[model samples]
Target: IKYLFINHYCTLDNLFDILLYTPQLCRVNVKYLCQLHDIILNEIPIILSNLAHITIEELDLPFDVFEIFIKKMTSKLQVLSIGIISMNFTYLDVNQWEQLISQHIPYLSKFHFEHYEKMPSLSNDHHNLLKQFTTFFWIKQQWFFEIHIDTQLNGVLKKLSIPFIHIGHVLNSSILSSQGIQLVISSVDERDHDILLNDYIKSIIISTNITCLTINSSMISCVLIELLEILHNLDSLTISYSSRLLKLHGCSQQSKHHNLSTTMNITKVNMCYVTKIEQVDFILKFCPHIQYSVQMILNYHH
Candidate 1:
């Protein structure tokens, strides 16, 4: 029965008992996955105890329903992945979310939550609860991960010691300056002028243990220089920018002089852009030690 579901209707809940006990079942589709989750919540206590990793997509269930399921099944769960149709969070608050996470999912090592458009707003008390969770649980854990949040969540994140990856608006300057951060991959829409004007970039450079950095093209030159100086132990760096912006900044002389003489430890540098090949060449010239390669790619005409 487990083999049948493993090979055929793996998404359905009919084989969940078999699957849960099988020890080898690691992956399941979202539609049938929830059914199995419901089964585990209702029937067997030890069914989900062996699950090492679980991922569910297209979940439209209420937050309370999901919280109950998590509290029941995630005692030994090490890796958790959830995908909602979109982040129109109307039914959950920070307290409820924090309570669910704290009571259940105590042993989780890796967690992934995806929100489509917007995240739910937590009250001040809930935010404080989140801060407590970050300090007590997230920081103490061996591995912790979260995605999708605006600058405001940085306050909570500052207390966490785990390496994290954030994919949203630039974090607050104070948050970037917090201690124990080791990696940052920022995906910012360059057209958003407000972020470029923000002081967070300088904060990132002056503080933190950031060793790996990736940024969009519109990152200001002053901030980039500051980052290069402060991230003396950086190993991998990627920078993406638009062609028109590259032209405005000029490529030739700037590229030749762009090397971080102090950051000899950097091993990889990836420069991605649309328009000016010269700018790419210039970046290559600056980082003479970095292996350079380029390919012609179509531009986004807008």
Candidate 2:
């Protein structure tokens, strides 16, 4: 089987037994239930050991289980998404993880991770755990095929992942390779504005191509505009605001596209609370050539 998706929680032992026979499977997505703690917490070692040699290239699993998988699994992964349960753990080993990535998973590039727990107050140790990722990427920067981070500003978890969070590229991804860089920041909060803004801009403003970008933020409009100005060849952009913060930058006369044109580079844009056509028209100015299928929020005068 080339792809397998399990929408419900299944016992790890039973899943392993099924995988053992499906040697041809290349990707698996199992929506594991947290209630199945026995499978994730207890049987991880055994589950990983049994599937050590499989060619599975992409996966989404609980954080701890995937941690074990990353260190032990022989298959080189390309894309990974992990639901982190806690940043407050005292025993998270960073050095071991660094060594594992450097040695075993050298081909891994794209990653998506977000905290699932309710606790947002990360202590110094939690920040350190997060730092491990920064360190790993920094070390592997020269070898990365391309880098991207897209963070969707969701409340509760003050996390950063988008473009880079939802998507990434390793030199050895099991799926189709992404050829360029991208950065997305959406739904960001003021609490994370200071440090994250400084850090992310400094890190990503390198000499590379950001082919696709999205900025659905108002608090960081100035920062986003400065970032857009720096990019030499941004192919597409999808930006929105709860209000008219960006649209007030005003629409451009130079941006002209046919309503039926289909060759633009921007992906789909989601806009709400838009009460005017000038607002949508102003957003389209970012990538005048973009052609998406979505009917941009049409606030026609009745």
Question: What is the C-alpha lDDT profile of model 2 across 1-302, one tens digit per residue?
Answer: 66777777655555666655665656667666232454433343222322222222223344455555455345655555444344324323557555656686666565443343322343344434433443444334432223333233344444653222322333442211133444556555544445335544444444444555655565434444445555555555555555334534323323322321233445444565567667666455455454455445544434
By summed lDDT, the worst window of 10 consecutive residues in model 2 runs over 47-56
- Report the CA-based lDDT of candidate 2 relative to the real structure: 0.46
lDDT score of residue 236 within candidate 1: 55
Candidate 2 segments whose C-alpha is farther than 4 A from its true place? 33-65, 70-73, 85-93, 116-119, 136-185, 188-215, 219-242, 246-302
Cα lDDT of all candidates, in order?
A: 0.45, 0.46
Top TM-score prediction, candidate number: 1
TM-score of 1: 0.44
Q: Could you estimate the TM-score for every candidate?
A: 0.44, 0.43
The digit string of per-residue lDDT tens for model 1 on 254-293 reads 5424555434455566666555556566445435455434
